[model samples]
Target: MIIVNSVEEFGQRYHSAKRWRRCMEAIANLHRLNPGVCHSIGDSLVYRLVDGAAPAAECFTGNRRYVEIHYYLSGSETVAYAPKPGLQRLAPYSDETDRETFSGAVAGRHAASPGQLLIFDNDYAYQLLGSDHLRKMVLMVTIEGATFHNK
Candidate 1:
């Protein structure tokens, strides 16, 4: 787990970081491969959700399609999920497959303040709770695992 004090620090560290480049490249290829993919971008991509604009929704472990990188620009967003050292469950979107990947790290009460960047691997299961009057910008890069791993 890594944390940066400000968005400038995050940009300096990750905008050009090795992983960032690879992630961008992988995402480009992923879009080319899968056109108009809903799994890539969510309904909130590049859009700001102000307080009372939308209710805080529960975030769960997404499927294995593309990686989700959440770069918090401002405000506070709370992430909740099943804690580790427990049964080790990802997320039970359905009853089945709950016990399969039950040993991975689950995201818990994590805060993404302004200038903080949070990267969730394909397996991390969690939720986002933005603070009241909280304003932030997020960039969701859709990177295919195959291309991401190959490079």
Candidate 2:
């Protein structure tokens, strides 16, 4: 996986919409390669996806040339996200309208929150539960071995 010291590096390579998606696919594969790849950004691990009659959860959506980590310094919510499906992969932005469309077929939720870190793949569809007031820090680290050859 690629690792960047700062967001600038992540931004430089992921400046384009297409390239950023590739990063998302790479990270998504990580989960398949190793389920343990999912973990908190910091200490304490107690996050899970739950199903219910809520606002479909909330998630910060963005793309970078690396795996992105979202830390919930405060606030309690559920995160629902899934990889951009099929040709619609060109989607970006975390707007509600976009989320509803993305959430059409996929599903994700946070069953519990016992820490202050949330790490996930890039550009995937996700939602936070409990409330709309979410305060957290986002970290995007470029994965190693990623190439911009075609981009």
Question: Which candidate number has the best lDDT?
Answer: 1
Candidate 2 stretches with Cα past 4 Å from truth are: 1-64, 86-103, 111-114, 122-124, 129-132, 147-151
TM-score of 1: 0.49
Q: Report, for all candidates in order, the number of backbone clashes.
A: 2, 21
Which portions of model 1 show Cα errors greater than 4 Å? 1-4, 15-54, 82-107, 144-151
Alpha carbon deviation, residue 89, candidate 1 (Å): 8.7
lDDT of 2 by residue, 1-151 (tens): 1223333454565566643544334433432332223333222121222222235333334354445555443455666556655214334543332222233444555532423445565546454445544443344444455444444
Each model's TM-score, in the order given?
Answer: 0.49, 0.40
**Which pairs clash inside model 1?**
7-115, 88-102
Per residue, candidate 1 scores C-alpha lDDT tens digits across 2-61 of: 445654565567675444654444434432342223332332222122332324553345
* Model 1 clashing-pair count: 2
